[model samples]
Target: MASSLNGKVALITGAASGIGRATAVKLSKLGCALALTDVVEAGLSETAELCYTEKVIVAQLDVSNAEQCDLVVKETVEYFKRLDHVFNCAGINPTAYPILELPEGYFDKLVAVNLKGTYNVTRSTLSHLKEHADCSFVNVSSILGQRPSKEMAAYCATKYAIIGFSKSMALELGPKGIRVNIVAPGFIDTPTNASVKAGPEAVERSAQSVSLGRLGQAEEVANAVAFLMGDEAKYINGSVVEINGGLAY
Candidate 1:
């Protein structure tokens, strides 16, 4: 379409903080109304307030819950009467224990919130998204999705699954004029990684690993997402836009 999002509506999960919140604000500035959801109500409300559009709606959503995903999608479509974009930014990042010492349910929990949550939101929005001419679905993955890390098998598995799932959906939905893509981000200074970035040495070590000698910012990832969702990338689909600062690994 190569047009703007002046009258479009976007549904963003994990909109409480980080890339999700940044994406919401970016879309709002581009003239898209927002349906922002997250498990954390406080952060989500703040995001909604920061949005420049008057058509913003905030909802509490635990993306792991499929039923809740359906409800939230229904509410969004009903409130806006149309949904043109989706950002699946709801995910968890935690260092998994070594295979031998891995907790019983740790893997399953990660699967539920990261992989399954992305699937839940995508499937819920498919019905309405198909009806739109220039619809887009963007899922968030991680650089770890392509490059493995020690003691992070569970997290890596979910991210890899998202890339695969999103690409598959892109293939399935492309003929229908609905674009599906993924954003694989490297080390970013988001709240989700507050623990990992707690120590200066840890932060410096991470920066040293990137060719740019610095970690990425949430808005950098959000910018890629906004571009992919907009008409500028109308011909792009089944693609993975990596936001890592040239990580050596």
Candidate 2:
């Protein structure tokens, strides 16, 4: 498995923390050259340090900006000389609230980051991916995208849209050997959930809510992503791999 990814190039967004950070580390260990980006400059540098290799480049990027997206993709390709995989892990989840009470700017912000951001990165990388063999894309969505929650209307909408967008891309790009897939993770124990896990009872409560009786780890999702990006999953495209420990079921 490691030999297969060695020397290949991957571009990962949201590489500063959470799933993105975990994925970047995992890929680096497999000997893949990495172009890592996130809006959080410090965290991105921290992640780059953890990679601890000259094969990695860290960039501060906001996926929502089309021009920035193009620049990052172009620069990564120029640096690596080839692009094999893209992991769109940059996203935001605002505090849950009912649609009526949701802040006026909140929905727009979420849409811009979660939905448009994914599109921007994918658009910028599509042509490059098409030129490469065995290329693939893995987008990060959430369980809320598949199963809606009472106060997560905006989040759900964006995630749901990701599934649709990924499927459409899978169809359009499959012929060119460019695969696209989505990962819907649930209750991942990342910094984004620090507030939810603050109390002593928080972990237990979260565990009980899932059928697997535990919270998912960022590395666990990274495992799924790694598989999807590799030759083993070459036959898998336009599919949504739910790494939620059967939470939605």
Candidate 3:
């Protein structure tokens, strides 16, 4: 267990599964209490149970809903008495379509969940985080944010916007001892994208494109996230830590 996070309280969004669940478990192992939220209630409860912390709270949250984000944040602070860390890990899977063929509604949905969702959670937590020292926030972006793929213009746009948003927030909050950073993962094997990795041939081809010749794991990404939220990464604000298994692109 890491003493640096002992007795701290962390609010994790998208805690139902994948990177979010892995991160919640990681923090709990480090002696951090947790407030886990996701739209999937059953999975959220399962995550809460897997956490080995003294205290854990679960909420069914849709990050795309601003009111829900605010309410959840308030509930977390009230339950834990303080919030020292936040992980905006809630997001929907990307829909790939060429720019010319993409639906406007899908683009709006992507922006709502990927970009504005981050904003709502961050805004609601800022006041609470500002009061504490060594507070940190980690927003999950994707390798797609930097490297574009065909038929993913809308998804890429949303991801790219998140990086800009995180950098701006880092600048605004760094002065107050609040650090903001991003973890850009590539081809991470998570439940959210199980279909994409369903076939062995698809998985093999994906692996070959990475210098490491493998897909990244959610736990691997969570490890990087844990570091960013700890005091050891105090000087790493406004940085993007890539966990893409050395993508060939």
Candidate 4:
């Protein structure tokens, strides 16, 4: 069945690739108009072309920039006349390195993109979302957020922060009828993990770690985001729907 999101408007960050791109396509299939933003202009255009509808607007945006976040949200609201759902998926995953061996600036950069970036977009669109009766927000976290990984301390920290931020937003927005939720994906087969997947042994080890005996796909995560944004998840605020193929728990 099609979701109640039909004809609704959604803004998605990092919509150029991976789970973000998949979510854009999925939501479009449900008859949602999309405002897709990413730093890669060409990739954003490619994603826009693949969407189910021509109501897609592509913008090159750096989610870490507060001004860009505000501008994009303003433009989307102006164009769409209302904002219904937001998917904050723009983030960076640095090379896995132990805390002691991590570069000086790497931690700050990841936090800026992964944590503060989510905050920036949410803050920019919170008021506009309030104007709608059935609005929602879905933030993309990761399995590392739920369980710490040995060499991914910085990435884990940012993902963990996302859950906390999402829960707090859910609490604050619930009374206003704007639901907030999160999705934590694990070992998704996407370009973002091209280097990791290049190693045959790494892929084998990751697959074995999951009970499902394989990695999750971007479409799987996208489906969860769509559910959280639709009426089927009307009472699912403050929830963290993990899509890790049983890798974590």
- Which portions of model 3 miss their true places by more than 4 Å? 194-197
- Expressed as tens digits, the lDDT of each residue in 148-187 for candidate 4 is 8788899999999999999999988888889999998888
Each model's C-alpha lDDT?
0.89, 0.88, 0.89, 0.90
Over 158-249, each residue of candidate 3 has an lDDT whose tens digit, in order, gives 88999999999999888888999999988888877743547778778888889998888889999999999987887999999999898887
How many backbone collisions does model 4 have?
A: 0
Report the lDDT tens digits of candidate 2 across residue range 77-154: 898888889999999964779889998788998999999999999899888874448889999888888887888899
TM-score of each candidate?
A: 0.96, 0.95, 0.96, 0.96
Give the total clashing residue pairs for model 2: 0
Task: Write candidate 1's Cα lDDT for 1-249 as tens digits.
Answer: 333777899999999999899999988888899999998899988898899888999999999999999999999999999999999999887765898988869888899999999999988888988544999999999988988889889989899999999999988889899999999998898887743557778888888989999889888998898899888899999999989899886
Q: What TM-score would you give candidate 2 relative to the actual structure?
A: 0.95
What residue pairs are clashing in model 1?
none
Worst 10 residues of 2 by lDDT: 193-202
**Candidate 4 residue runs with Cα over 4 Å from true position:** 194-197
The collision pairs in model 3 are none
